[model samples]
Structure formats: structure tokens, C-alpha cells
Target: MNFDTKHIVILTPGFAASEEDSTTIPAMQVYLKTLIKATPKLNITIISFQFPFTTQTYNWNGITVIPLNGKNSKIKKLFIWHKANRVLKKLNLENPISVLHSFWIGECSFLGDKFAENNKLKHIVTAMGQDVCKKNRYVFHLRKSKSKIITLSQNHHDILLVNHHLESEIIPWFIDKNDFPNLKENKIDILGVGSLSKIKNYPLFIQIIREVVKEKPELKVEIIGEGKAYFKIKRMIKTHNLQNTITLTGKLSRIKVLEKMSESKILVHTSTYESFGFIFAEALYAGMHIISFDVGARKSIEEWYICSTLEMFKITCLNIINKIENKKTRIVLNCPENTINLYSNLYDSNF
Candidate 1:
């Protein structure tokens, strides 16, 4: 079937409620905004399956967004899919969608793959976060379908290949350097970002801090973001008597988190896994050293130190802190334009 090359539709489970809602998938927000700015002539529309909790269509940064308000109820998912199909039909009738891009390889991809197969449209599914590692039934369907698949990092691509024997393209998300603030003096000695969830492993972060403070009691540490594990983490902080040494600044805006990164010396990411840790790029751009596990897109840069064991984390933290004055702040990975160009080529290509 012939399709209009000027229009594209994006499918996702959730999206930022408003332009000001920075906490909800900030990386995706940066990517979409950059994509819009880079391609002025392209028409983009977003179909959010389970966010904003409203059935209202609105505009965000000049792009049209249609929220289905699925609210993530398992029993109501089929009804939501039916409504989404109706919306897509109306949208296609008005302006034929050239391509369908879904954020995760789950429900959104399932719907997009089916619709695209029926309508002869190109579909692309980007595997985000745990969806690649988890036991998702949609992976099997997508493997047998015609939709193109993309993974954020090499780690994610390997996992998808091993788990489902699926091949995918790698398109890492990048940070926009222009959004950062001026650097400030290093007031906080250490920093940790990401949700306070079990996957993030804030408990290991607290344990690392507890060990570090034994040698240098004047250590100042701060953790940003909030999640279901807040209370348990708080109790651990209190029990370790780290109230003075550590501060929990729960859920800061994207700008505020960048500001904190500017004033910090080092970033310690203890997460068990990451598809592509956006924080790693953000911290590196802020000129902060990163100490993380061998997860995500592991780079060979000197400042990004990857650790394997708890002992390695402790040693790396101490070694970096002892000579923190000698470290320099430099831009490592700020390639929003490159990412945009890659996606633009994919959108214009024939599947």
C-alpha cells in the first residue's frame, strides 16, 4: 500500500502528563523534543496507552498527543486496545501514517505490529529497559512479525539476541548539552540518581556510603529520585546514622538533577541493570566521574570506572575521592543530533 512519507505515529505505555512533567521518562522527552526540532516538516503524533489519566488530545512542543488513559489496568487492556484502534483508524483516514514507532516491545509493539501488518505500514519497536530481559510474550510475536526492532545499547542487543534469538539495531539515546547549567564548586562529594527501587539497588549504595564514611567521616552524599523503596532506604540510612553524611532529595526535576550533577564530584550507579543509563551520559557531560557496574553501554573512557564486586566499588570510591582535585570536567557523550539523524534516516527508508 502507498503511504504518506510526511507523517509518523508513536506508541507508548506512558508519557509525561504535561510539558512540565520531567520525572516521567525524561530521556524519551529529550529525544522527542530533539526529533521535532530537527525535522520541522515532519508531522508527528503520539498515542499514549496508559498515562495522563485522561482521554483528551493535546499539544506538546508542537506535536499532537492522544492519551487513551488506560491507567494500567490488566482487565481494561483489551478495551483500551479497541479504543486505540479506533483512534488510529480515524488518524489514518485524516492523514495516512507513514511509520509506526513503539517505545517498548510489549503491549504497544503488539498493537503497532498487528495494525501495521494489516495496513502495510512500516513498524519499528524499541526495546526499553527490563522489557528486553523480562519474560515478555510479545517478543515471540515480534520475532515472527515484520516490524524492525531497535535496542538502546550493546548490552540490551546481546540480551535480546540471547533470550529471544532476535536481531536488532543499536541506537543509543543521547543528552542535549545545551540544557545543562553552568558548573559549580563541588559541594557534594558523591551523588546517586535514578528511582529508589530494588532494581536501582539503593541499599547497596547506602552500604557503600556506610563503608566510605568510616575512613572519611566528612563525606557528603546525596541520592535523587523516589520510588516504592523509599521507606526501606530511609530506615537503612537512619540505622546507619548517615543523616549528616547523606541526604535524600527525593524526585528532583531534570534541571535540578543536572544542577546537582554540576556540583558533585563523582556519580556511583549501583543499579543491577540498565538498557542505556541516561544518567551515565548526563553525569559525564556534567564532568563528573562515574562508578557503575558492567551494565548498559560500557565505555572505555578513563573517567567511567566499571566495577564488578562490592570491594571494587569501595576501592574505586575511595581512590576517586582521595584524588578528586586532579580530575577534570569534560563533555563525553552529548550526541542528540547524531541520534536524530539516525532515526530520520530510518523513518525515510523503505522497510
Candidate 2:
């Protein structure tokens, strides 16, 4: 693949819908905006299946947004591949589309395969985390057919190799340093970010907080974001009498969450798997210590803290607070530009 391509299309399932202020969504927008800024000649378009009202033409940072509409049913979603396949064909007929990039390999990227086959478009699918981590039998064929899958961590690459029986290149998620404050002294108690779901392992978080408070009795933990586990998590918080220590902020704007991250002393991530740990990297960049269970891209993080299990996680948290008292944590800012540039080079070459 050449390292310089001017036109491309990205197919995504949907942007995170947190009243338009989700951290995940802004993180994506920031990265895409940076790509646009770096390569002004590049024309990028995002086609989302979730948005029904997207127009034939709309603009953000010189990039185009196109949404395809179809029947209102699960069948409609299944047939989106046909709709997108036709649209890309028309696009090729008029202006010769370049690369077709799929953000994840399952449904959204399935259309990319059809588009590539029909129009000879260069196709690439970047698997985030869940698509590969959580196993399901229904998409077995989809897993087998996909080629050129991109992953963010070596573990993710290994997961695909072991389970899906395929090889994938690593393309770590990027974070714009300009958007993050430099690592400062720990001011707040503890921080947790991500959807409040089982895979995220929120119960483990509650358990760790309770253990830490038993010793110090003053330690506090804050959880950000909302998910199906809201009520259950609230019940646990109340039952443990952690109302004074643990706070579920529900869903908040990206900036507000960042504000909380900036003030926090430690970040506790308890996911079973991660394609790449975005918030973990962000916390490290902000100069806060992080202690995460051995899941996802936990090993990918450089220069910080880690734990093997929920029990080890509690011990690690205590040590982190003690280190804060001793003032001995060293944090560094690692740039994702090299990784992003590598992917861009690959895209250009494929195009």
C-alpha cells in the first residue's frame, strides 16, 4: 500500500449515543479530525447504518457524511450490505472510490467485502475489542471470510489467531496529546471509565473499592458512563454503604469526564478483554497511576501498574495510594502518531 492516498470511506455501525457528548465518540472524532488536518488532500466519508436521516451531502472538517436508509427491521439491517454495495458502486462509477475501511469486521465491514468485490475497492477492517473478544456462533462464517483484519493489541491479534484462526496486524488506538492534560499530581481518589457492563466487570470494581475502604475507610471511587447494569450497580453501592466513597456519575460529556480523570489519583480498569485500552492510555498520559486486571491490552500499557486478578487488584490499589503518599509514580506521554501513520501507509498502499 502506498503511504499517500487522497480519498477513502469509513464504514461504522454507529457513533456512541450519549446525547452527542460521549468520550468514545469524541475520541473517534478527534482522531479523524487529526487525520484530516494532517492530510488536507484526503477526502474521508463515514457511512453509518444507525443514522437514518443522513443526507446525500453533509460536511465536517472537509469530510463527507452519508447515511443509507432502508426498511425498518432487523431484515433491513441485514440488507444494508446490499444498499451500501449499490451506493459504493454508484460512487465508483462517478468518481472512482479509493479505499473502503471498516471500523469493525462484523456487519459494517461485511458490506465492504461486497463493495470491494463489486467495484474492486481496497477493503480493510479494524477490529476494536468486543467484535473479537465476546464469542458467538452466529457469525462464524463472517469470521472465516474476513481478510486483512487490523487489531489494536498483540493480545487481540493472538485472540484472532487462536480462536478465529486468522492473523491480524496491530494498529493501536490513537489519542491526540493536545486534547489531554499532562500527568499531574493525583488530586481525586480513584476513577473508572467505560460502559457499566458485565464484560467491563463492574462487580470487580465494587469489590476492590470495598476492600480498599475497609483499610483506609476514606478512599473514594467514581465510575463514569451508563449501561444496562445501572440499577444492579446502584444496589451494590447502597448495600455496601459506599455512598460516601463510590459515585456512579452515569453518563457525562467527554470534557466533564476528562475533568474528573485529571483530578483522580488512580484508574481501575476491570474488563475481561480489550482490543486496546483507550481510557487506560489516557489516564497514563494524564500522569495518573493505573491498576488494571490482566484483560484486553493490559500488557500493552507502558510505565505504570497492573494486577493479575480481582484479589491482586485490591492489593495493587492499596500500593498505588501508598505510592501517592510517597510521591513516586513516573508517568510519560507516548504518541500514537507512529501507529496511525503505519495504518495510513497501509491504506495508501492498498488504495
Which residue runs of candidate 1 sit more than 4 Å off their true CA positions?
1-5, 324-327
Error of 2 at 75 (Å): 4.0
Question: For model 2, how does the per-residue alpha-carbon lDDT over 109-161 read when each residue is reduced to its tens digit?
Answer: 77777667666667788887667754734236445453467887877888877
Worst 10 residues of 2 by lDDT: 324-333
Top candidate, metric TM-score: 1
Residue 264 accuracy (lDDT) in model 1: 95
RMSD of 1: 1.8
lDDT of 2: 0.71
TM-score of each: 0.97, 0.88
- Please give, for residues 1-351, the per-residue lDDT of candidate 1 as tens digits: 212257899999999889889878888998988887877768889999999899989998988999999999999899999998998899999999899999998899999999999999999899998888748877888878989999999999999999989999999999887879988889998999999899999989999999999998999999998999999999999999999998999989899999999999999999999999989989988989999998898798988999988888989999989983754576657478778877888887885
